[model samples]
Target: MENRWFAYLIPPFIVTLLLVAGSQFVFIQNSFYQDLGLGRTGTDLTLVNYIKFFTDSFYLKTFWITIKVSAIAALLTLFLGFPIAYVVARMKSRLAMFLLAGIVVSTFVTIVIKVFGLIIIFSADGVINKTLLNLGLIERAYSIIGTQEGVVIGLMHFTIGFSVLLLYSVVVTVPPSLEYAAQIHGASRLRVYQRVIIPLCAPGFVVGGLMIFNMCMGAFTSAALLGGGRVLTLPVLVQRTVMMEVKYSTAASIAFVLLVSVILINLFSLIAIRRLRSARLVVA
Candidate 1:
């Protein structure tokens, strides 16, 4: 069975690799060419587009902003998700199980609908702003839409359900014996989680964080709908450049940069996690 497993996996893996590599090859070719207007591009190989992406401050700023926003969203999702995941994982109550089911259902809703719903909720005249105004939290309707804060908030909403689900699965895998042992050794409930559960669930946290970060990095709808041109992310910029300006080369350039950034960041995070895990093992 073990020997046959590779044979089963190899064919699909090759096919997937070919499809992904083929599309990326096209992007690489497109990135080298110069846009000649009207969805046309020159075949002449040049580094002009790549140079422009690095040299221009606006493009650089957008790249950094996208990274920053993604990081913020990832962190916020983790912060808000872990507690719910822990609760769901450890819960014996029917109500808690029902709530977990609701959270799982939330992830299945179409992201387009979710983005539109978020837009309505974050709009200046939305229920939240109206409520805040009525409560004297502010003088008038505070606009969350068309801002980075709005984009991050929407991303948190988008990611938290998935994060919770992932973390819940991870937490469930951890044997209750370890936690019970910690408690038997005079550790308080908080201490058990802090010293045992959290450390044991480190891999889940990393997986959830990376998933959320990657989603936010390439996310278009939230930035487009909530950003309202005020928070231009790399994906939104790529869309505008291709559709509005017909700059295929530039758009490809932006996309290629984003791809590289995501890959490098993922690599860095994986390496850091491995190092941390190794150090933790050494300490133990």
Candidate 2:
């Protein structure tokens, strides 16, 4: 059975493997892995760029910042999405359809559009500033633009939708009888919702959180636009290296690191999901 499954996976896997091979061809050829346009002159096999990535305070700081921002974004998505999922899951009307439509629309919207929209709203002379100034909130508008706040708000544009969809799907699988039993057993509404519901939905939350964290960790568009280019995420840094600077080998190395990190996160999440399932079965 496992062999049959492997056979089914082979075709697409082979094609993707070939593509990855092509991508690495240049890196392997150019011992030092510089830009394509730059012809190798003399020295090769140097790992200077990677050492710089590690030793340089600038790059290290940006790496830490990316981790911090992505973590916060994932947590915010969790807290903000839980209620919407519960409400929409329980609802049986056109209003639920409308909320689902909003989630669907949010997923379909382009990141660039959301970033530009936020830019206009939070710009120095934009609506937020104008409204605040008019209301005498302050002599100057508080700068939300080009900061972590801007990045978080922009990240939430997509992540909130992801959270809602994932959580909603998980909630649908939960047996309604459990909630009824809890209520009949004298549990309060809040207790039934929290104690009974949340524990059961842990797997979906783990999956969704890891996915959101991974996406935000490598985010380029939102971080660049909202952080005003000051927020240097791994993807944007990789882009700058590949596109602007033309450092292929170093970029390849960091890209490898990012891919490995994602694989490990997913692997750990799978283990956690399995453990939760096992524990639930034992309890049953």
Candidate 3:
């Protein structure tokens, strides 16, 4: 019975593998062709699209901007989420469950709605600007729309709940007795967190950071809405290349480059983290 139940998983797994791998192969294969405009691709395979992506300053800048925003957003999300997760995880009251449920629901909310809420709050005549103006914090109303800062904020809003959930799970895994022991040994509260909690959660942090970074990298609705068409990330560039420019081949090449870059970065990051852990073990 158990064997028969396990067998049910294989068909869906194969179907998923075929759908995902098959589509990716088809899409990436188109990158080798040249764009002839009007949604048409040249019959002859060429490296022109890739070459153009590398040579063009605009594309390079967009790629860097994407990385920068994603990295910043991921780091910020981790920082902001850690404290909330810690507090919630340590809570003895039922409120903790409520908080977690709230976070989960908010996280799953549609990005379009979230972006619009951000816009409302950050608009020139919105609550934030009005409060700042009233408090004499600024002479004029400033906007984050069309700015890199806005994009970063959008990304953070998108990923903060996930970060909290990830860190919360990590925090819970750390035995409370360890924190008590550290405190009993004359360690301060801060010291307990620094020496006991953080060290144990390092692996979780790396994994969570990378997951958030990957999400930010591929995020389209948040970037598009927050950026206001000024700040162009790789995903946005790919969309424009395909939809506006009608250059399918170039878009495919850009998409391929983005995909490869994310995979390589993640691979290198994990390898580097492993080396660091090994070094620490050797030192100990």
- lDDT per residue as tens, model 2, 97-195: 899998889787998987788788887799989998999987977766578877887787757888898899989988889999999999999898678
TM for candidate 2 is 0.81
- In model 2, state the lDDT of residue 247: 64
lDDT of 1 by residue, 89-196 (tens): 888778877988898788878778998887787567898888998899999787878888988987887888988988899899888999999999999999998899
Clashing pairs in 3: none
After superposing candidate 2 on the true structure, give the runs of residues whose Cα lies further than 4 Å from its correct spot. Answer: 1-16, 24-47, 268-284
The window of 10 residues in a row where model 2 has the poorest summed lDDT is: 33-42
lDDT of 3 by residue, 1-284 (tens): 99999999999999998999988887888889988998888899899999999999989999999999999999999999999999999999999999999999999999999999999999999999999999999999999999999999999999999999999999998889999999999999999978888898999899999999999999999999999999999999889988899888899999999999999999999988889888893111
Model 2 residue 76 lDDT score: 94
Estimated TM-score for each candidate: 0.89, 0.81, 0.95
**lDDT score, candidate 1, position 72:** 98
1 or 2, greater by lDDT: 1
**For each candidate, how many residue pairs have backbone atoms clashing (under 3 Å)?**
0, 0, 0
How does model 2 fare in lDDT?
0.77
lDDT of each: 0.88, 0.77, 0.94
Model 3 lDDT on a 0 to 1 scale: 0.94
